[model samples]
Target: MAVSLTGTRISVVALPWFVLVTTGSATRTGLVAFCEMAPYVVVKAFTGPLVDRIGPRAVSWTTDLASATAAAAVPLLHVLDLLTFPLLLVLVAVIGAARGPGDLAKEVMVPEAAEHGRVPLERATGLSGVVERLASTVGLAAGGALVTLLGPLTGLAVNAGCFALGSVLVGLALPRGTGRAAEDPAAAPAERSGYWRRFGEGLAFLRGDPLLLTVIVMLGVTNFLDAAFASVLVPVWARESGHGPTAIGLAGSVMGAAAVGGSLIAAAVAHRLRRRLVVLAGFLLVGAPRFLILAADAPLGAVLAVFAVGGFGAGFVNPVLGAVLVERVPRRMLGRVNALGDSLSWAGIPLGGLVAGAAVAAAGLVPILLACGTAYFLATNLAGLRPEWREMDRTRGRDAVKRRAPA
Candidate 1:
């Protein structure tokens, strides 16, 4: 989780600044980001079974180390006068590819860690959410300062270091035999089945499950909307409102801090919360008003406060989703399911910048922001009222008791 938060913070947060600095073009900056996320979504979709077959812990460490290497190479190449746009694209793409597995590995680890320690998945998931939110808060603030004080390269350097630290932590911290033992012994023979067949099994399971499918779809839609919000809103607000990059960074930090606070609160009371309603209400709160607030272009203080509130709602989101995913899938299939869900959930990310750029060009920023916000708000709330959502809502109260029963 630490690795995910920090690594993503640098890659997503600072990489844009790096591109802008080097190229002086928002379109080019967005393109660099597009390069990273596009491959990431593609690789993650297929890598699920591989993650299940091997183990998330091993994948996490190895990929994180690789990410560190890839990220570090950018600056090193720049220093060597070899940092052409093509080279930067390739390196960033590699970093994005590595990040796919790295993120899934970390997410997969959450359930394992909870199960191994006999912790409630909801509480554990909340903690993981807190870790991510906290990292974003710190990383955004730090990335901003790092970029401002020492340039974008320094921020990238810091990102590499964070990945290195995260790799070390995951590699050393997990139990020695945990990764291997988590694999299904009976599946050793099936592992030799064609890769496509194995991949089909994962897909088949998702197809068979109604609740999981519903959640996946909801998240995917939300993610696409979020992509629009994140990619377009910040830059527009920064440019139009006279907030500059520093304010942009600070806004992210405020959101992260609010999210962290929400996660901590959720962790404390997670046992009592209904998983579906909590998630639904969070989505409602997070999606619409915040975007409208941004679109309104209020005073700086109001913008920050609005984002902070939005972040709080977002903080409530991940833990519930994580707990649901962890509980729904068997440990053996966790990696594949996690990767699959994540891929769908995040598939909208690349489109975020691209769509945002086009939207801004075509419709101008304010109207687009309002449209995105309205779409997110309506989509999430309407989805929450679905029959499938009721299943999760009904289960949470009774399941919490059963979950806490003695082994």
Candidate 2:
């Protein structure tokens, strides 16, 4: 999982620079990003039931192999001077489409893995977050250096290699029956259901749960904002500030390193913390400030400090959310529900780069940063005040009691 994610992060770190340098157009860069993520969300949304029906393990390995092929083709074509802008978009889109299911399949495996390993769900998810942060730190650092020194294509090639390795691991390393659905009498009825029926079941579950709905909505907005920051805003800052790709690597590495520390701490103690407080504080620290700080043209030291602190705060969020999700949803419905929930939360991401690019082209970087920061602040803070948010904390207590109750 870490290897696969690292590959993805490397591409993510390098792709914007690749497009920006190749085309010398921010809009084109945004368009390329949009091409990739739009299909990813859409394909993942529809593939959830398929993952459940066929089993996540098979889906995971297959899609990783597909992703590896598509990612590898980009550099191979570029080397032959056969890669046009349109061709590049198409290849990226393929990678995104394959990645969507691959990512979802892996996520579905986590709860089962946690159970098999006898770890708490929160701790397992926290460890997952740590893996992601560590990957991001290493991948982004490597990507920045590769792009700055060797060029972006090297990063893409490494991404392909990682995907290949990930496919092999998933196919060979996991215990047999690891990702198979658990034996439950109720699961027979679900297995008999058609794809659309299963999808509807997942949607109905989400519609009835106000807390889950709220989390999805809040995350959708925040993810959109984050997408913009990663794809357009940060790269633009690096370019305009004369900090170059190395500086981008440094900033991201610092943030990711701090996030790793935070995730480790959360893995150890998050179960004892108030979910609402942790989530709200995490959002408060994670959102807006980095954008605002960058827009203000603060000293590099101050900017790095804000990013590190924000990243630390950001680390607490996913573990709490993941545990709550596992508690609320049944194992049989995990693939579908997680698919629907994640798809909804990520829905806004497709447009994030496109909008940021256009906005920056017209209104300039500082304005876009300031505006996005404000939107992020309102989305996180104002939304937290919603009555449904009380459900977050309540669910944790109820789950604890359920765990402690006599069998």
Candidate 3:
């Protein structure tokens, strides 16, 4: 997961810059992003049942290989003078399509990995979050340097290589019998029940859990804000401030480093904490402050300080969410349920890039940043006031989750 995600973080920098410089238009940069993430969200929603059936291990390795192929082709074709804007869009779409299931596969495998290591689930997930932040730190710095020194294509090629290496690791490094589909009472007979039925079961489970629904809804709004901030607002800010891509990378790296420290603390003690309070507190720090800081015309030092604080707060989030899902969803239904939940939360990601670009074009950077910051503040704070959020602190186990009716 770290290997693949690191490469993805690099592309996060390389791909946007590639489009922005080439087109000299923020709209097209976001259009390219839309071309990628639209397929990611749509395909991931429908991929749940398939991941459950075919198994996440196979899905992980194969789709990663496909992503590598598509990612590599962009630079290769560009070098050959065969890469048009349309062709680049098509390749990125393929990468995104492949990535959706591949990423889900990795997520589905997390519990199995935890069990194999004999680690507590919350700690394991916290460790996973740490890996992600570390990836962002290393990959963003490397991406910035690669783009600055060697060009964006070089960074894209490195992403391809990372994907390929990740494929080899997933295919070979896991223990025997580790990545097989989870077996349950529904397993044998459900083979004949067909895909839509399985999908419906997952949806029904999610709908019955108001807490999970609330979490997903709140995350959907915040994810939209976050996606916009990362993909457009920061880049534009860097350009406007004459700080360039290096500053963007530095800000990300500093935040990511702080997040790693936060995750380490969470791993040691978050399980003992009241999850509802931690989550609300984390969201408070992670949500709106970064956007407002960027809009403040503050020095880079001030921006980095706010981002580090936000990053520290971010450290508490994923571990809690991962532990919640693992505790509430049966392993057999994990792929479908987790997939649906994540897809819903991520639904606005593509639109985030698109709307941020269009919003900035109309209103300019500072106004859009302020508006987005306010929206983010309202989303998290208001969501925290809901009764369902209290369930975040309730204890749950797979046995308890299974006792809940499929209805």
Candidate 4:
């Protein structure tokens, strides 16, 4: 997961610059981004049932190989002077389409992996979060340096290499029976069910669970806000502040580094903490402040400080969420349920860049920043007050009962 995500982060950091430098148009950059993410979300939404049916391991390896091929073609075509804007968009779309299921396949394997390794779900998920943050830090920093010193294409080449390596690892490193749906006898019969029927089952389960629904909705909004911050707001701020791409890399690396530390702490101690308090505190720290700080136009040091705090808070959230998700959803429904949930949470991402670009053009940076911050603050804090949030703490009791029960 970390290796694949690192490749993705590198591509994300480099792609906009590649488009902008080549076409000299911000609109084209946004267009390319939209082409990638729109297909990603849409494809992922429908692929969940397929993942459950065909098995995550096969889907993961195959789709990763596809992504690697598409990614490699970009630089290769560009070097041969055969790349056109339309061709680039098509290739980007291909990558997005392949990545959608590829990512979901990998995600649905986490719980199974944790069980196989005899690790607590929360601690395993926290370790997963740490790997993600570390990957993001390294990838973003490397991308920035590569783009500055070599060219954006170098980053793209590296991204292709990462995807290839990830595919190879997934194919060869995992145990033979790992990630196969039939490994779970309870879920095996469902593999014979039609895709739509299985998808409907997953949907019915999700719809019946208020806590899961609430979590999904809250994350949807927050993910949108975060997407806007990373894809649009941060780049604009860097340019406006005369800090350049290096500063963007610096800010992201600092935030990611802090997040790594926070995830480590969560893995070590979160099992002993109250879920409600930890979740609420984490959300409060994670949301709004980064936007507000940037709007305030504080010194670079102050901005970095706020981001560090935010990153730390952000780290606690995913591990808790992941554990909650695994507990609430049955193993048979995990793929479809996780796909639906994640796709919904990520639905606004494609529009984030487009919306931010339009809003900035009309209303300027500070107002947009303040508006996003206000929205983020309200969404996260207000959601915590809902009754469904009680579910966050229920898992421990349920687990204890199961452990004490006869096999």
Candidate 2, residues 135-221, lDDT tens digits: the string is 989988888888889999999999999999999999999888887643335455745467888899889998999999999999999
List the global CA lDDT of all models: 0.77, 0.89, 0.88, 0.85
What would the TM-score be for candidate 4 when compared with the true structure? 0.94
Clash count for each candidate, listed in order shown? 0, 0, 0, 0
Worst 10 residues of 4 by lDDT: 398-407
TM-score of 3: 0.96
Question: How many angstroms is residue 322 displaced in model 4 relative to the true structure, after the best TM-score fit?
Answer: 0.3
**Per-residue CA lDDT of candidate 1, range 1-407, in tens?**
76557656755556776776567666666677678888899888888888776777788889889989998998899999999998898998898899898788777777667877787777899999999898888888887777777887888888888888888888897667655524455665756455677777778888887887888887887887776666555765676777766776788899999999999988888767877778877887778877788778788888888888888988888887777776666667777777787898788887777777776777777898888887887778777778887777555554566445432
**Residue-by-residue lDDT tens digits, candidate 4, 1-407:** 88888998888678877886787555566678778888899999999988987899999999999999999999999999999999999999999999999999998888878877787788988998999999888888887788788888999999999999999999999888988862345444554577888888888899998988998899889888887787778877877888766767778878888899989998888878888788889989978899999999999999989989988998898888888887777776789999999898888877777787678767888999999999999998888999989878987767654433321
| Winner of 1 and 3 under TM-score | 3
Number of the predicted model whose TM-score against the real structure is largest:
2
For candidate 2, give the lDDT of residue 367: 94
TM-score of each: 0.93, 0.96, 0.96, 0.94
- Cα error, candidate 1, residue 299 (Å): 1.2
| Rank list by lDDT | 2, 3, 4, 1
**Candidate 3, after superposition: displacement of residue 359 in Å?**
0.9
Model 1 whole-model lDDT (C-alpha atoms): 0.77
